[model samples]
Target: MIELREHERKTLLIVERLDGKASVEQVINESGLSDAAVMRAALTLQEKKLVKMKEKKQTIAKLNKEGKLYAERQLPERRILDVLYKMGGEALLSNIPKEVDISSNAVSVALGWLVKKNWAVINQKKGTIALVESLLTQKPKKGADEKLLELLAEKDTVVIEELDKNPQQAVATLKRRKLVETKEKSTYELELTKKGWKLVKKGLEVAEEVTLLTPELIITKKWRETKLRKFDVTASGPAVYPGKVHPLQQIIQRAREIFLEMGFTEIRGPLVETAFWNFDALFQPQDHPAREMMDTFYLA
Candidate 1:
């Protein structure tokens, strides 16, 4: 006869009832056991050579903050194209903001995507943007990225396998643009081995086992009636790394404390400043090398 714990016995019975093959979720629902508990029992059964476990990996996609916003409002490129179409199919790049509600920072991004998707063209020397002539006659269709965004908006999460039209490329583009995120998910399927079936044909016993000996149990003398659970001392425990302050933050804090001890008062000001306040107001010449594009970091 094979000896089993209560949860293990329950899991095996459910697997057998499922025709010797069952998914972790199926067992979880039928047995009313938590995911972790079911997985633990499955692992123990595998260790005893009673069952075989197979793991399948899948990619799940979800929209991030930017993706949600873009999905609600049309993408920047799409909005720009609509505005250009309204302006007789051509407009100066600087004049687009007056016609559309897109942000100044997003104008460049929209322009890039417009040219990339062949929906519009940009004249860099002339500083103008024009929609493709074909778009003027025919209604433009949504790109794969746009379609994926709409799908994600309707449903918060989607499995990559369920998507059509070469989702891998679309997912990669969305991920690069910081609009969508993908994570790997694993599902386990358990099947009974011949040995497992033979054990089922014979008889098995499940006894109440105690993993911990508490003071109440000791006082009540119940420990004597329950079987103590077996432990594998050779197994390693989970790795732990205690948290500590970052080195740079530690240095900054120490400097602040030292300045306070020296009887100095601390003052705070805005971390960012406009060009006038940062350079022009300080009598810095516009032609100065420090103000050049390559030397300076400019915010859009």
Candidate 2:
């Protein structure tokens, strides 16, 4: 006969009910044990040669915050394509940045995907983007990347294997765009040994664990019937790192406070300032390279 703790016995019973094999998620749901408790019990069972833990590493796809926003609002590339179709199937490259209402930085990304899908083509000399007649007239369809994003939005995360088709290429495309991120996680499944199965088949019961002693229980003389909860004072619990502001932000705040105390006022400048303020106000040379188009951002 082997010695078993209350939690170990409970965990074994749940695993036995699951046909001798179950994932940690399944065990947690069925056994009603906290994650730490279940993991501790699994380790104890493994040491006793009662259960073997098998781990499978799987790549899962999940949408980031930006992806969620994109899912709600159609992708920038799709929006660009829609606007191009409405505007006689062609538009100047410069007009697209303002017309599509998408960030100027994303224009190139949208154009690249538009060309890749054969939905549109860019005329470098004319600085215009035109639809591919052969593809535009046939029909509009969502690409694999867009489809994957919609699916991920519905389900926060999905295993690569669960994808319908062309998972590798589809994931590669989304990964490149940074719309979705992939994480490798180990999924653990516990298998019961012959000895464990036999032991669990004998049946088990949930132990009574009381959290508090009440005066009513003592008055009713039911103290002997109550089982107190077990606590391991020697075992270290989880570490906690309290929330704190970023070091850089703290330093900036302190500097701001010091300046105010010294009767100094801070003035903020607009991000997009004309050359008049940037160059003329500072008495900078107009012919300086820093004032050139290559070195400066000009507001249209």
Candidate 3:
């Protein structure tokens, strides 16, 4: 259950966007990864079982329901927290109404309190009110697991594209605890773990595998190394490039320097300007397309 690195996650996302049908070249291009780097990450993901090979030509990283939920909570818009200093084991969703600043839809979904869109429990003691549900329990997914089992049983190798889960992340939560092993003489394959078989076959679900990052760990210099993301959704500024300036601008500056060195003052003109200059100054007809605002910015 090792969490993937940030760069590894980027590569995985590229493969997912390729629609479970990308060559390594396509992955490298979209991910802005070098050929060597992309290959290395792909092999790592496959070995870790976060990604599975569909064909010899394509690779796809898959995420279960747990993975999707984890990633979703990490996003700025969906993220929330509470200071539960009193309640050690259990709490109520009704208490969340005043503590959290999100829509009720988001609160209900995150709490796992609703069964058939109904709150599992509602209690009133004195003037205080509380609602309770098994927060660690799995939210009922409509045929999501059945679909996965049917697909897996049909094919020896799965692309993970048709999976209802977020098939783009390497999750620490759902990493195979015990890999499937072959009982054959010549070859070996992934054998289901005791935990895995029970989950897939029986209608039983274990607790959620959410990892809580410690406050001390979050203060670490590179906390993201521990798969904890720090977000300031409230931070103000335009989008960032996160690196140095553009290479095209650098080339232009160099050209500017080269022109100055050649004892020539640089002058700029449009590639296709108005007919007032393009044709009128050059002694041509006035009814040119260059005079139109669609092709040129008119002074009117």
Candidate 4:
């Protein structure tokens, strides 16, 4: 959705031809463009945010899991003494910036400070978290999920792989219990025994609802729950029209309008589709330089 310069646009075409990724020479050779022109095009592509450069070199990112665990721990020795009960803590240390964008040294220092206050403990070997006396890590106890798994144990379930990724654990647990048996392959293979449905129903009742919100939560509907809900009519909606849609939507709409005005019919499809429609139909081939998720749609 980023805008591009003429040079960048050319580079984009070349990169698309290469499947969203290409080396410097590849862009030049494929575009039939000069070397300098290609380099300038590539730079322009990067400037407009349509392209990102990975310098054929190894890149290392740090992750600070320990820091995260530790920070989730509590504070203030006086306040801690007043509390009757305690529960779960936050992240631990050894998390580098790559993991959660935190510095390991800073995290370590903070933990040390906490330890001095008798607020937290540090044990690198066990990856230990100082959970409070009330802490309990509980997974859902939905026996219903187990039943769905039992039905799915049949050989011929169509969406087996999906179930595995999304609901496999319950399935495996049910199968292990021997409540439902796999009898056949193909054509809706398994039959759910009385036990299976019962398990699934039980699971549905006990399922927990977890919510995570971020500042940019508006990007997804599910994320909206993370924001503070306001019922005060005094804090109403915008009084005057902002006269703006999301920037990406606005730009894309303008582009479509321009193209329509120029007598080009708009082509509409999902961002998730086969590579053929996204690239080949657009005059790009397997070797094209520009076929990449950043520059184009990700087929998967």
Number of clashes found in candidate 2: 0
Worst 10 residues of 4 by lDDT: 184-193
Best lDDT among the predictions, by candidate number? 1
| Residue 208, model 4, lDDT | 22
lDDT of each: 0.88, 0.85, 0.46, 0.46
TM-score of each: 0.63, 0.68, 0.20, 0.19
Cα lDDT for residue 265, candidate 4: 83
Writing each residue's lDDT as its tens digit, candidate 1 over 2-71 gives 5688889888888988999999999999989899999999999999999999998889999999899999
Q: Model 4: how far is 69 from its true place, Å?
A: 80
Candidate order by decreasing lDDT: 1, 2, 3, 4
Error of 4 at 279 (Å): 0.8
Estimate the lDDT of model 3: 0.46
Superposition error at 124 for model 1 (Å): 3.5
Question: What C-alpha lDDT does candidate 4 achieve relative to the native structure?
Answer: 0.46
Candidate 4 matches the true fold with a TM-score of: 0.19
Name the lDDT value of residue 295 in candidate 3. Answer: 75
- Which has the higher TM-score value, candidate number 3 or candidate number 4? 3
Cα lDDT, model 2, residue 123? 97
Give the per-residue lDDT digits (tens) of candidate 4, residues 94-183: 332233333555445445544554445556776643533333243213244333533433332423344444455544433443433333
Give the Cα RMSD of candidate 1. Answer: 15.2
